[model samples]
Target: MNFRAEIDIMPLKELLDPQGKAVSSGLKKMNFTSVEDVRIGKHISIKLSANTKEEATTQVENACKKLLANPIMEGYKFELIAE
Candidate 1:
């Protein structure tokens, strides 16, 4: 079996995001004022061999915890689908 994973990792809401804030401010200056509370994150797409969706999810979660995200200041979520 094969699985595909889509992952999103972002900073915790309480944590300060200087880059996101900066981008938001910039957007306002550019007349895109409706944009607010903007936060930036990474999206990861992965393809792998797995016996089940659950296994794929577990593997992706472990990978996220180990290297994809900073658990202390960030949160991550993923979806696994059959490929």
Candidate 2:
């Protein structure tokens, strides 16, 4: 079986996002005042072969924990779709 994983990695809420803040400031300068705040994150898509959805889930979670996201500063979530 083949599976596709969609992952999101974001800075922890306790941490400051300078990139997001910069974008927010830029938006306000451009007269988009309704936007109060912004936070930037990464979206990742992965396709892999696995025997079952549970195996795919484990693979995706391991990827996130070991390489894709920083546990101390970032958090991640993912969804798996059968392909």
Candidate 3:
């Protein structure tokens, strides 16, 4: 079976996101005052062969924990689809 994983990694709410905050501030200066509390994150897509959706999810989760996301300051979520 072939599977695809769509992953999103974001900074933990307790941690400050400098890039997002900067963007929000810039937007306000540009007259986009309604924009507030902005945060930035990363998206990752992976395609691989797996025996089942559960297996694929576990694989992707391990990848995220081991390499993709920093556990100390980040959180991650993912979805799996058949492809």
Candidate 4:
């Protein structure tokens, strides 16, 4: 079976997001006053082959924990779709 994993990595909510803040400030300066806050994150897409959905889930989770996301400063979530 083939699976597509869609992952999102984001800074922990307790941490400050300077990039997001900067963008938000820029938007407000551009007259987008309605914007209150902004947070930036990464979206990752991975396609892989696995024998079962559980295997695919494990692979994606391991990828996130080991390489894709910084567990100390960032958190991640992913969804798997059959392909």
Could you give the C-alpha RMSD of every candidate to the true structure, in order shown? 1.0, 0.6, 0.9, 0.7
Error of 3 at 65 (Å): 0.7
- Where model 1 places Cα greater than 4 Å from the true spot, the runs are none
Better of 2 and 4 by TM-score: 2
Worst 10 residues of 1 by lDDT: 50-59
Residue 78 lDDT (model 1): 86
lDDT of all predictions: 0.89, 0.96, 0.94, 0.97
- List the lowest-lDDT window of 10 residues for candidate 2: 52-61
Task: Give the per-residue lDDT digits (tens) of candidate 4, residues 1-83.
Answer: 99999999999999999999999999999999999999999999999999999999999999999999999999999999999
The regions of model 4 sitting more than 4 angstroms off are: none
What is the overall TM-score of model 3 with all chains considered together?
Answer: 0.93
The candidate that wins on lDDT is 4
Which lDDT value does model 2 have at 61?
94
Task: List, residue by residue over 10-75, the lDDT tens digit for candidate 3.
Answer: 999999999999999999999998986899999999998899888898899899999999999999
TM-score for candidate 2, residues paired by index = 0.96
Two-way TM-score contest, 1 vs 2, winner: 2
Please, what are the lDDT tens digits per residue for candidate 2 over residues 1-83?
99999999999999999999999999999999999989999999999999999999999999999999999999999999998
Clashing pairs in 1: none
